[model samples]
Target: MTVAVEFIVNQLKQVLLEEQVSTNETVRQLHGKDESHHALSLPDIVVFPRSTADVSAILKIAHVERVPVVPFGVGSSLEGNAIPIAHGISIDFSEMNAILEIRPDDLLVKVQPGVTRSQLNKELKKHGLQFTVDPGADATLGGMAATNASGTTAVRYGVMRDQVRDLEVVLSDGSVIHTGNLAAKSSSGYHLNGLFVGSEGTLGCFTELTLQVYGIPEFVTAGRAIFGTVADAVSAVTALLQAGIAIGRVELVDEDSIQQANIYNETAFAEKPTLFLEFHGNEAGMQEDIAFTEAIFEDFNCLSVEFEQDNAARNKLWEARHSLAYAYIHAYPGKKLMSTDVCVPISKLAETISYAREQLDIAELAGGIVGHVGDGNFHALLMLNPNDPQEQAKADHFNEQIVQYALLRGGTCTGEHGVGIGKMKYQSTEHGAALAAMKSIKTALDPYNIMNPGKIFT
Candidate 1:
């Protein structure tokens, strides 16, 4: 083991500075795992690559050495997307974090993969622009793109894959390629940007990324509508969407999730199923939308609707929804979070959520259902005792039922989490022959199967 370490370290140091390549146990452990319950596997070494050239060099050496390479960001991925199961070399991209350019004219921004979505939003705000994808983790843009992540705002803005215009990737053979052109819309070859954005580092490492940005809306309204039941809340969303409400963000926080939020944050939210809504438009149009939504809310048995006129209040209103994950972690100390995400068609939203709730209850799983319901996507946040196999099985059973329900209703296994290690078991069941096509693509690109192996596929 030390002999392999000695040879690799010497070669890596020749390309990167000795300090940039680390073999410290603490460092290796840090790079090995993500924020998931999956068993941790330590990388033999962690390499910090600052530029595309640095990444290319590392890939070249690793490819020649037949060593696996895992591209890491902030380790915010809920699935085991970033974990190094093969324990080869972990290339941490945090040092490459940079906003390279902001083209206001084209509504585009160029950035290195390591920059966080929040960081980009801050810079974009100065120019009256915003990066629309909000995965809610302040996650590195690369990881967000890798997971094809979305959040509350995705109802209107879209997922990370939708915002990407171009990607500068370092292939497994150490060759560099641009997966996309900077054009707004392209009818060109293969749409490699889409292929790579959710590849979860199995295809290549994203060195630089170009994304579309949006101008800040003139009037942004945020609110929460309390409903008699989760079905009512979901139905109201579907009604509003059908009515063409032009809603920006719409989320569902169940009563139990609200209870957890209230307990953790010391806030008073109605102990009922709720729909957190937001609309982006001019004042008059927003007022029209508000009235229309209110009328629809009443039709769906909404108990109360409260709107936040100011930014601070809007952020405060969204606090409960954003804090749901942390609240669960806080509620069950030492237990790991196993959030299950499944998306169904809009027509099946209410039934899908209701089914998840009923299944969780019947299974006696410690979980709550919360989601970006407007997108027909939701997560069952299940807290599992790390040491208890029976409890873990309950959580797994609950998750499987949810997936089965969604799949039967023409839904995919995961909406935004991508095909991480956690979801690999569902790939064959979910994609069938298409999964073989994906594996073929993976083979064509990485051939060596060294790029984040044991992820996507078993």
Candidate 2:
């Protein structure tokens, strides 16, 4: 180890328990990368902080040393947001995981950074509540907040930023602050909650979060709609939304994705462009919505529409949908998944997806198209042989084309996945002159660039 890093490590060991701090190669390596296809970069050391005070202390030491500090949760971020690219201190939050509070009456929950989505829901189940901003993985709440992640339910429940009522953040200089409060709405002060939630930890480290939750719906029904083409499926989603159908969740998976799901999950679903759907309401209201959705899908040339009210069947259906990513990974052994996340206007989703399919075909890459189409966000799961430079180049070009297409159409380069290293190149084009403002904010908040450096900016 470098003498500088060694000295920093010694300084950290003074404030933390010996077991909480480690310079071991295995621990450092584990903290080096997330679930992204981006290259791994190891940190100098890994520290487990048990409380907000512990996190503050770690940041104080790192700030004094002018060392980069990356906040890490369960390392499930798809864009390498948790990767310590600058090779400094990696602050792992596993030890700090605790569901601090659940105010059922207020529909709010307080949790430490390490608590995962499923863990929270499991406890909330007893109180007939659910935290609905699911990104499909059992990712930690802190990591989810960092990325401003959203998945199928975002169309109805809103994204991570909407759920975050308050954040206890440790700034770059080790000063702790709460970005928001428990109040439902506020016109007070600058909106720091929005700034910190999706900052990818570049501005501060989240120690605790106060989030909005929802009561479990009284009636739930799931459906699978088949269409002749991807365009028809996407068009159906748009029509449903325009018709004001209250969809709980709506996801689109193309023929390739369905085939992968069938092969991996061993289910006999049709190999066609499909929409996995769900509705939430009173039984009468849900039935009305489902009827409207079916009629709309039929109008869009849907081949078949099937609905299931059984909980087991609904869970099984979602399980297949959630497993789509793993299915692609399992199908392409030795190939890493490089998924593209792009969102467009709901009116433009059909054409955008058509363009994506065309680009995927032209690129001649093995990939599948899937999306939470209810909100005009979708992904192209491109599988590339990481060892093959030529293949990697092709995938890169493919991703760039899709992102650029979305940007030109007034859409975001990344709909949900935070700008980790993957989508950093397109930020200027996406944000235009506004990027300067973002940089100024970053510099003002984290002058040393110690918080998750080399993310969301070049």
Candidate 3:
């Protein structure tokens, strides 16, 4: 008796330094799922590719063998984007971790797929440069670009797609190519960077990336604006944006979220609807901007406003904002965390958030709402019991209602999470005819559907 793909994988595993080209159950389980709400599914084999040639060879072999390939990063994805459902080969990119080059003169850096955002920033700090897409987790750069992730700073610096200047991808046929160039903007070719940034690894695997970086600002100030109601907090955000404040981060977190943070992080923060705000500029300009922001907050009926001017205090404030989701997990044991995000025009944000809160109350789900309010995007996180059918049903109902409401109001079902299995159902409703075009591209790029099958669309 003989196994079909096992012998070939063994041959490949012998030469590759970090490749786990084994069919072991333990190895399969490691690449199965991400930190999302979806259930896990183990792939048949796991392979860790250390270079572009390694990735190309594996893809060529997998294609010839008719085995599916899914890219795995740090397993921190909030959507099911990293889960390997087809049970074939899981390609883990952690071994390829390296910052290939840093072009300080050009304000750009080239890195491998395995490099995490935090790791890059740590190295860039010495050069007085930083990457701004802080998506709660210190996820891999390739994974961030894959999902088009953005976080609190995205309101000002933009998403991963915006930061990417070029991408070196390994296509299914083992062909390596560059998506764009180093120039600031490009109208060249088919806008491949746009197509691949949020492709979720269906088209190809990112081997190397060149991303834009910003210099560390001269001055920084962090502040918190407390409001009696979520409406007041949201209104303050809208007004600040309308008044043209050069804010670095504007996060809207609820009172319940603050209470959970106090418990989880062991810090004393008032339990009220709050806006964690930041300003970045020279000292004189920062002071002027903060004064204007304070006036607008007062106009929006903000109860109280406080500022922290020191670096240590600013770091503490932002840390609390980043830990909001984890706070929920700690606050409720044996419960799964599911978050839904939607982006609307600034004018419609208040109505959307108010409606989302109502759905949470109607379903009796215990969680909190917090997100990058500066961009009119927010997420509703529901703490649910995965094993309890009734509780899961309640959470599911809440998600459907919230997404449907956003769709009706011309907002996306997922602003940054990407259309993994969870958001696939809404694609038809959200995209309509555009969905057909997307399917065409998917078929054109991956005819055999060996790349991340059953994700986004089947």
Candidate 4:
């Protein structure tokens, strides 16, 4: 470790609580990386901050010493967002996890950044409330805010940014500030909340978050629609979204994905390009909404549409969707999974998916395409042998091609996954001149670049 990193580590060990500070305990392999396709790099020390004060103190020392400090949570990020690439202090917020307060009437909750989505949901269940942003992984709320993560539910409910009403942040100089107020809407100056939500820990460390929540719906409905080709499934999704359906979730899974899911999940789903869908509302309203959705899918040449009426079947349907990435991981034990996310407008959904499918075919790679199609976002999981240089190169080439296609067609390189190390190369192309503005903001808040360095803008 460098002298600066050592000094910071020693300072943390001196001031932080025993449960919070550990150089020997923190230098483990699991803390070194995330779910992304990036190499692992361990931090010299790890600090688990229990409160805003703890984070402030750690930030103050790190700022003075110019040592990199990465905020870590569940480490479920898909873009190397939590990796301590600069080797300084890794702040694991797991100790700070506490659902501080819940407002059942207003449907909002105040929580520590360290809290995981599932943990928060468990607490909210008492009040018949739920947090809507489900990113498949049991990611930490802080990491999700940093990455501005969204998932299947984002099609209707919105992403982490939308759910977050207020954020308590600790800046580079250890100054603490709240980004927004408790009001439902704001026409305030400079939208700092928006600026920091997806900052990827470049701006500040999230201390606490006040997020929007929803009461559990009276009724829930789930369905599956299989199509002849991936293109047909894509077209059906685009059509459903255009028809103004109040869809809770709509995910697309290609035939190969179903095959992998069957192999890994040990369940039999029809091996075809399919759309897994859900709706939330009153029983009558949900039924009408689903009926309209079925009609649209039929119009788009859907081969078959099936509904799951029981709770067990509905849960199983979503479990299958959420398990897709893991299924791919299981399919290749020794190999790694390379996932590329590209989100286009609803109108361009079919074209983008078709183009991606065609490219995959041309490359002759065994990959699976799945996504929250209602939002025009999708991912192609390219399973590859990382040790094989040629295989790695091909995977990289395929990722680059898909990203380029998305950028050219006015889509982002990453939709939900933040611009961690994997997406940094495409920052300029994705944001154009605005990329400089982001860099400026990063420099302004983190002049030392100690907070999660080598992520987003690098």
Instruction: Tell me the TM-score of model 1.
Output: 0.99
Model 3 residue pairs with clashes: none
Provide TM-scores for the models: 0.99, 0.99, 0.97, 0.97
Candidate 4, residues 1-458, lDDT tens digits: the string is: 56766666678867787667766744547689888888999888888888899899998998888888888888898888889898777888988899999999888899999899999999899899999999999988999999999999999899888988999999988999999989999898788889999888888899999999998999888989999988889888888777888889999999999998888767888999999988899999888888888888887789889999899989988888899888888878888888889898878888888889888988878788998888889999988887888888887888899889888888899989988898899988877899898888888888888888888875
Clashes of each: 0, 0, 0, 0
Instruction: Provide the global lDDT of candidate 1 against the true structure.
Output: 0.91
**Which structure is stronger by lDDT: 2 or 4?**
2
**Local distance difference test scores for all models:** 0.91, 0.92, 0.88, 0.87
- How well is each residue in 1-458 modelled by candidate 2, as lDDT tens digits? 88998899789889998899899999888998888899989999999999888999999988888999999999989998989889898989898889999999999999999999999999999999999998999999999999999999999999999999999999999999999999999999999999998899899999999999999999999989999999999998888999988889999999999999999989899999999999998999888888888778788899999988999999989999998889999999999998889999999999999999999999999998999999999999999999999999998888888898999999999989989998899999998899999999999998888888889996
Model 3 scores a C-alpha lDDT of 0.88
Best by lDDT: 2
Clashing pairs for predicted structure model 1, backbone only: none
Over the stretch 177-245, how does candidate 1's per-residue lDDT look in tens digits?
998877889887898988998899999999999999999999999988999999999998999889988
The residue-by-residue lDDT of candidate 3 on 1-458, one tens digit each, is 13866765665676565435667778778788888889999887788887898899888887777778899899998779989877787888999899999999999999999999999999999999999998889999999999999998987899999999999998877789999999998666798898999999999999999999999999888989999999888878888888888799999989789998899888898899999988888999999998888888888888888999888888888888888888899889998899888888787788889998988988888998997999888998889888999998888888889889888888888889898889999999999999999999989878888888989987
lDDT value for candidate 4? Answer: 0.87
